[model samples]
Target: MDEQHERADGPFRARGGPPWRRGGPPPWAPGPSWWDHRADGGRLPWRSTVLVTVIVLAGSTMAAHGRAGDRVGLDVFAYLLLVLASVQLLWRQRYPVVIVYGTALCATVYLAAGYPYGPVFLPVALGCFAAIVAGHRYAAWGAVALLWAAHTVVGHWLYGYLPPPGDGPAAWAQEAVVAAWVLAVVAVSELVRVKREQWAQARVERERAARRRADEERLRIARELHDVLAHSISVINVQAGVGLALLDSDPEQARTALTTIKAAGREALGEVRQVLDTLRAPGEAPRAPAPGLDRLPELVEQAAGAGLTVGIGTGGKRVTPAPGADLAAFRIVQEALTNVVRHSESRRAHVQLDYRQGGLTVTVDDDGPASHAEAGGSGNGLAGMRERAAALGGTIEAGPRPDGGFRVVAELPLAPPAPLSEDSR
Candidate 1:
């Protein structure tokens, strides 16, 4: 029977994994494209290399022409420019500031030397994209702005001609067009960065909330187990003692003690069965009237029956919490009173239950100084009570009272459950 009971309620038998992911592997098993480090950072190094190779070949092809072969000097310069720009791609992410600056510098030099701008500028655009994706938005935009300003300044002063084609109005239009393109890239990159940060923060908050709910659920299970087991165990201990003491002098009384033992065990078995029935399908209707604020009188009577002098008092109106909130309040009071019975040195303790418009407050105070220390050091009773209160967005404070005893005060909100109607159950 004990083995059967163990099998019935063992923690290891609890269901594992979320309902959605219970059957299969997640989608990104092979990993996503953004995290791909292969293909040389998707950099197209061979494009630059081939571009330079074409420039070299073009210069060689034009060697037979007249002063056009002198124009081949420009092709050679473009080839060298491509080589330098391709090298910048390798260190783009690791040293984005250096790479952006270097690319801009080399492009300026190649342009000034009369090198062809088309082949050399391809790597510059790639470098700009790389800088933004590397997680440096502000710096990337700053470098772009600085580069544009330098081009405008240098073009009007150092170079003999304006930066692009046409006179005053057309030239200004071209500059505006280029500036808008640069700003568009910066805006897109910044949007992506902001979205990534928001997503990460939201995920963290969700995980934290899930963990809090899991902890509350675990504490609720523990309270139920304790309420069932502790009473049964205490009764068993009392009866076993009576049986041992009456063994020789009163054999009939010893038999009566054994009968009481059987009755206690049977009661324990019934409660355990009820708990299991409740656990098996939580979606099923509740089997018993939930213990709540109304049950405090009954709880005190039970503690008194267990041989502790428990007192009850009230300072305010009566409280009727929502089903879950009431259950939490009940658990906190139950654990506190149980500790007074099991751990106090003195026989006397007072339980104060206060109900206000704001919330329900329960406080347990014992006249026994060092009751907890004398019985045993710290244990899970107080911790469980605090956890129960916190589960309901409430608070619990337990410590030595001013009157030289232990005190436990718990305040629980009177909020109702969302889906359940107040009149229904």
Candidate 2:
């Protein structure tokens, strides 16, 4: 495992980076909000501030010139309109609707008061953009319609003038142009929404995959622990039984039994630590050599040392199998031997391994008491061995044999089928 993925006892930590900074800005921080972080005191760039200041100054100059010539009073209302509209740019993302509608109203008033189109119309158009970025598509369209209607109604009712019949087409055409501009804004914002949704879903899938992998790793660790601990414990159980029975008659042999117990404990601890170290960092731990068919003789010898008459025989060339198949073979034999010690009343058992061309076959038969059949028929051990064999696409059969003994026979494929890697499990 990588250091970033180390499994410590603590709060859960998210395993990936933020969604932003991947080419385009994330949807939540798009448009004006992207620049929101760049501003000092949350103010616009100096260039925009200077431009707005220059526009206000130019508007005041025009109003002052007109007032001096006695053509109009200095339009204090117009100056206020320009200030209100320009200030709205600052709050475009925070209060998009309020700023847009406010700027639109100010622009309408300024235009109705006979101010030039340059400064007044600029903010009005920019407000439409702010509304789109805020995802108010319908509201923006309504605002566009209202602007056109207000321009026509104010011109006719207050000024006593209307667009001529042929001029009506030109007026409607201008409304269409504004509609197209709003439509373009809507299209871009929707694309950003879709991109953000996909990014969010991808994050969810990645986390789900990580959790599944962690769970599988934990299960694998449990299986390894069961295999290593159960086998060694079974041997220790038989050895301790013999040592206790012969403590007075065979003192030296009993001391040897104690030594074997110590050795088994040390071996079990080392196996456990090796498993933990590998899980902690797969590359740091050395791989332990896997047990296979060749180890069956040693396994039988250990059982015999515990005073159970045991026999192991190989029927073929004893070829090495693939790793998965080898592990399955070892587990099958281990579980069978464990059952013979735990469940059988008889002291004599046979362990056989046949390495044929199609696959390897394992058989464990014990001639325990005739009534031992009823005692060991719980089937849990057998069921687990069967499941293990089935997982490797193999077959297992276990029950009472005809000659008053329990027999377990399993045939495992030499090469396991390809595992289902695509599935998260």
Candidate 3:
């Protein structure tokens, strides 16, 4: 990745799109809150547990009053059972199995004691829901099933032996109601579990997509900065050297070299500003059109200032390509010439533009005596060129020529030629 991207601005801001361009929850959309993260893990749910306990205690007391004659009244033992069941809910996130069993057992004992039934079942329902949602399905199901079975045996057969002295077997309709309630709890828990899993999966996908977008944007900015600075600086360097060499011996020539340096610097500043404007105000229209093949003449002029002669040639039919291919072709040629100016002792480079029925081909060649000693290039120009080409379903080949020079050839796909129709022919 070229390091031209501004880290502080971030990828979303650099893309010149709206605040919610991609991978972000839109402003109108509701996002997960701090409470939402508490679904499974994090801090213990202290406030919720205390609230449940309070409600259960008050409800159980009210039931004792409503059923004063039918069953045992709310005594200290009955109150303790309700508290135990509701309080165990605190650890449902971390120890759901234990809470499920504890609550289920507490509710069974209270019912077995012949106490009035009311909010006494609320804690058991909550425990089962938590356990199931926490993925302890078997434990939750078995705990509820065993509790219901124990209640059935006790209410029907063991009641005479254990509770309210002479209460007989529970009605079959009562067993049916209990079974229905258990089914409802499991169904609700399963629904919530599915929703939570989907939410988590979507969140993962969104984050992954956001990271990919950020990296691509960074690379693009880096490539642009590299090309702009490398080409312009190469020209400035050459001009500055000429200016110093002729400072006293040839005052007029030295002054011309300084002027060329200034021109190159100004042009570089303008292009750099254009590249950075996207990062600074991503939502605005560009200050200038992107450079394309039409700028090849300007590149030739710039290379001349760098003391490198460039010969441009064209073959095949000339046709306009898509905007992207035009830009890649231009940049590929620019970077190839910049590399030659910086690393080759040759004073002349050749650029060939071949437009074919299939696509556009750009080639840059420079004779070289391998000046690696003075080649201060960071080596990313060719990589950036290849990246630009590949992004447009194109290919790039760059290497030293077998006999003498370094060559860069790029094949960038244009829009498919429109189908021929009957015309003047």
Candidate 4:
């Protein structure tokens, strides 16, 4: 009755039953049900149908022979009960508990009516086995207990059949054998139920792990695209404004600004294509090497061309960092310089890089008032810079300077790259 059990049994629906029939399968099948071909290994229900039929026939024949001395022949009513019980097994997968309870009731009636005891109990045992395999644990055990109680009460009143009959030691030994058989069925069913639950839990864990991996990959791609577009587009925007301002008064200056815009547009296009290639074919190597701290001189030259005076400073011996840390450090400086060009009124900017034993520190300062652009414009630039630093276990700070300008500082740990193995080289 649990939701999980219902989902597990979803593949086992009966076909061609009456319109009024709701839960259980129809009494007889005109042909094979759709689920018969899909169950377990396929054709499972068909095989079970054949096996149960054979068992009923062979059991009835043996029972008729065993009671020949008592003149108790196999009667029409006895044959009819055996046929009904065996035929019901074809729907065991769809309605396991229903089949078991239905068959048990029939067997109890036959016994209480003083019919010859034989393989009439075979269908009842088979139904319980089917219920267990379908993950109906409580229902199977409950049916077992109820059937045993019925057998004891009915047999005692009609034929003096108790667990330990009143006849003597011989009768007590027979009852002990029947009790052991019943216990074995219940034990086997419990072992199967435990195994089914373990397999289902393992499948769920695998799906969750796959979803987590996909989410992380998407975030990485988004960060790369943001860095490439923000830095490049900001430069183009500044150059375009300068070209428009000097178009009539200073033709020569306007020509230089237009030239800078052309170069920035070309560079931005190539970088955008590279980022898209990585998304399209992730297994291939990147077309161009990633920019890093070594490219800062070129960056400063570009800013000077855009009419901003920039100065660079360094301290201590230079040390190389792992690829991830190098990329993060480069993006932090690029974003800061982009902000200075687009948002600040200052024309002069100073950048300092300090290399320490523990890590590397970068600071960028510009002499400008804190405009509304710094306070409230879309925060993507600042947010992207912070994300890059945090990914490499670093930190970044950006705010107004006490003297009168804006300042940005970042610290990044220098993680050494792993040495290549002989086989890899």
Candidate 5:
């Protein structure tokens, strides 16, 4: 079970997904003026603000004309209060906490002056809405509460002393209506705020998934090109040396060496071109099927061209692995034999594949006297093989064997591994 789990350093190590965004600071918290304020990006909602201002100014005038007897008619002071409340909304997004209180206070004064009720409370509703959506719940609730308290005092107790003289106390039924309106406005604002936060989180998740997919694509391409070029180039290097050494004494043998070099070069160019075409237009279908365990004979023939003989064997009932695992097994074997031809004086290598119900095992071995001078190639081949196995819920082992020479064993499960959880990361 442990062997079937992914390694801590696999390519998909960070695939659990991006961390969530931290909640913004409270509105009343002191900071730079712009901190944790705006809702719809940084730009002000100037067009909507201006439109609301226009509608409120006209709507308030119409509403004032319709008030009950003894209610004061619209005066210059009442219109000025309405204008101040409407215009203050321009900065609602940038300073929601300030806007809410500013608009609420304007409405309280307008009512206390005995101005006729109209759409006068619209600006207060908008300011409270903006504040709540900007993550200033306490500020929003307080603004509305203060407005309610002031309105109750003026209508019930202070009516004897203030504005449009000879008016009696407000009815109990009217207070209940005002209370219901308050609750509705607050409840609606809270619902909208929640939806906006959910949408923002979803956008962040999409961006993280795109970046993760791109990283995986780059890694897969790097491994495929490494395996393709390394084996082909190693074969060409050996054949070229043979061709040059025998040009005078054995023309027939030298011709065969040159022919092998051509074949290896053609194969490398073809594979490299396939990789480039895939990059150029990712949506295009592949020109050829990916090589798999069935292609081990090609590796054997290529090794022969490099003057090394490779033996192949299989054990247990043969069962076909998935496309990805089959490709990984093929690359591991090719890389191991490439090492044998390039860095070992031994002229022979052996590859074995063992099939089972749960997984497939690949092993490559050689009898060797190490060629120390050429043993210092970049270690990407082994790392790539390890990545491939681990990517498929498998494990890899590669090192010098006890008696002599190097060996590599890969265990690739039939199923892919699940991504690491956030806690695991």
Candidate 6:
């Protein structure tokens, strides 16, 4: 059977067994005959049904004509054998080997009874073809060998024994013809089986590739959302704490902190909404370009507003990286600064950007109190930063500094972006 059909059919059951064992309708049920449909849907197997029907009709007509001169009793028995053999062809695809065996047995009986040869051989030949096409190559060939032996032995018994050696070429030619026909059927069936398997394998690979793409897209969206929310929320958290502390003694400073918190919240909401909108409708134009090195000063200002004095320093000639690498670099710095504001109990932090020959390096260090030794030790923030760096073929290191406070360093390669395919355009 085709692999697709086999999967659809649920599982194999012993031939002629109870249908209920396989959760199928009884074999003799009158309504919507189980034999008329395949497992792929409830749709009728019209093509197979028509093919089997035509073969049976043609074979029966030829058999009746061949046996017209035989004894009435013998003719009736031959017709019975022909019917038995032909009826099973309908189920050849579902129980190919079984049908082959049954048809071979009926042919053997017909030959033994001395019925005249005509279409009596058709069913057995078709059964062999069906079995091989359904992936029972060995079984189909074995049945052919069995039928050949049965015919030879039965012919010798009914008629005079063959003359020794080179009496004539007629018998040899006949045997050769039968063998060639069976071999031809097997060869054709094998070719079709190989092609079917190749097609099925290709289909499976396509599905796997599609699933992998979906997983990567999901991860990209998650990373973007994490960067936006973590940084913005961290800034808001710090500003809110500062506002609460200064409310009584310094009303002006408290108002400034409140303004910073509101700004941070709005910015976070806008970026998050942009990410979500892109996810919801990918066909739309992108809301805005992603944050990159150009935004570092804004990030430093945000951190400063959150009560952390931040200093920025740069080295080497500045060069813009590819879009993906740029976004990764920006997120790494943002996440690091967010960690500084949230975890470090220090008043001062430093961000250093170094543009080198092949890549860019970002280092964030904070002079926080030693009591907060576990600051930025390990969490989703650091993990997200590491993931972003790694995706761009880069690396990140985060730990406490030997002097004081915590430090996070990321190195991002500045590779060119892959060109878009024509289909993408």
Q: Which candidate is the best by lDDT?
A: 3
Candidate 1 residue pairs in clash (backbone atoms < 3 Å):
none
RMSD of each: 10.2, 8.3, 7.9, 9.8, 6.3, 9.1
Q: Lowest-scoring 10 consecutive residues by lDDT in candidate 4?
A: 1-10
Error in Å for residue 4 of model 5:
27
lDDT of 5 at 259: 96
Q: Model 1, 1-425: lDDT tens per residue?
A: 11011112123236654322465323212112233344133454555545644653454335424344222244455556657766666656556656676776776666555443344544555566666665655556777787677656554555445323332222666567657867776777667656666676665455545555555455566667766566556545656777899899999988877776676577667767776777688779767676677877766655654556778888787756788788777777777766776676766788887888968888889887554444332366676677677767789998887878789989888894344332442
Looking at model 3, the pairs that clash are: 16-282
Model 5 bad stretches (over 4 Å): 1-47, 171-173, 244-254, 415-425
The local lDDT score (0 to 100) that residue 163 gets in candidate 1 is 28
Q: Give the per-residue Cα lDDT of candidate 1 at 218.
A: 58
Question: Which residue runs of candidate 1 sit more than 4 Å off their true CA positions?
Answer: 1-91, 115-123, 137-146, 158-180, 218-232, 251-321, 343-425
lDDT of 6 by residue, 1-425 (tens): 00111111112233533354567753322122223345224444457656655665566566656656551234566667877887777677666778788888998887666555566677887788777765677888898789887776654553443322222223756767767876786787778767766776665455445555666676777777777877887788778878999999999999999999899989888888888888788789777877788888888788888777888999999988888888888888888787777676787888898999989899989886644444332357777788788777789999989888899999988885455553463
lDDT of 2 by residue, 238-265 (tens): 6787689779999888888877777767
Tens-place lDDT per residue, model 3, 216-269, is 788887888899999998899889989999999999999999998998899889
User: Which model scores highest in TM-score?
Assistant: 5
RMSD of candidate 6 to the truth, in angstroms, is 9.1
Judging by TM-score, tell me the better candidate of 3 and 4: 3
Order of models, best TM-score first: 5, 3, 6, 4, 2, 1
> What lDDT score goes with residue 26 in model 2?
47
Each prediction's TM-score versus the true structure: 0.57, 0.64, 0.80, 0.72, 0.83, 0.77
lDDT of 4 by residue, 1-425 (tens): 00111111111235433322455432222212324443333334767777877888787779768876442466787777777888888877767778888788877767655555677777877788777767666677778777776666655453544222342222545556656766788787667666665665565454445444555455555666666666666676777778899999998988998898888778778877887888798699998987788888877877777677889999888888777778888778877887787778888899898999868898999999644553322457777778777767788999999899999999888894354553463
Clashes of each: 0, 0, 1, 0, 0, 1
* lDDT for each candidate structure: 0.63, 0.65, 0.83, 0.70, 0.83, 0.72
Model 4 ranges with Cα > 4 A deviation: 1-44, 55-79, 106-136, 154-158, 161-191, 356-358, 373-378, 416-425
